[model samples]
Target: GAGVSQSPSNKVTEKGKDVELRCDPISGHTALYWYRQSLGQGLEFLIYFQGNSAPDKSGLPSDRFSAERTGGSVSTLTIQRTQQEDSAVYLCASSLVAAYTDTQYFGPGTRLTVL
Candidate 1:
């Protein structure tokens, strides 16, 4: 059984470049989430997807950040006109259910570095 996984373990981009991070959730998991973590900072929820419902984007920092989950499986997080402040580790997690008490499995994350 595979857990959540992300691609491009590391990314380096200029201050104004855009980047897309990908995630693959475990099989049969119905809930997926995106988070961002800065150095020495805790994980900050960015978006969430449950089944076929609309994603929760309230945690997105600004208009430059967005995400989408396709077929209730794979998810992608895109950052437009990236800024230095956006440099951090982008993490993905998936759970069996959408409840707050459900157990979530996390991916290794993609480290984004803005120069």
Candidate 2:
């Protein structure tokens, strides 16, 4: 892909339903990241993956949230039993370099709404 690609640009679900968001990263990129942005909460890192290294999943809010990256490429984020507080935009990014300071290219996020 030229840049990251995210599916279902907008999703509206009743509270308690589960939702799955997908991300397709740029070609040859080795690092991928997931983030969430809310009304006032700026971008919050959700997870980080670099090649075969252990992923950083410390940012996930609860057991209801999970993600996985396969073959160092595509990734999926699943939220189970979504709540009203979970309504926000889920963003995905990728970078060629795997460092704290590396610049990442972001995808048009999947907007999740729980009502």
User: Local distance difference test, per candidate?
Assistant: 0.92, 0.91
lDDT assessment of candidate 2: 0.91
Q: Write the per-residue lDDT of candidate 2 for residues 1-115, one digit (tens) a residue.
A: 3889999899999999999999999999899899999988899999888873535789999999999888888888999999999999999999997787878999999999999
Candidate 2 Cα errors over 4 Å, as ranges: 52-54
Q: Spell out the clash pairs found in candidate 2.
A: none
Highest-lDDT candidate? 1
Instruction: Give a tens-digit lDDT track for model 1, residues 1-115.
Output: 7878999899999999989999999999999988999999999998888975645779999999988888988998999999999999999999998896999999999999999
Q: Could you tell me the lDDT of residue 65 within candidate 2?
A: 97
TM-score of each: 0.96, 0.93
lDDT of 1 at 49: 89
N/CA/C clash count, model 1 = 0
Number of the top-ranking candidate, with TM-score as the measure: 1
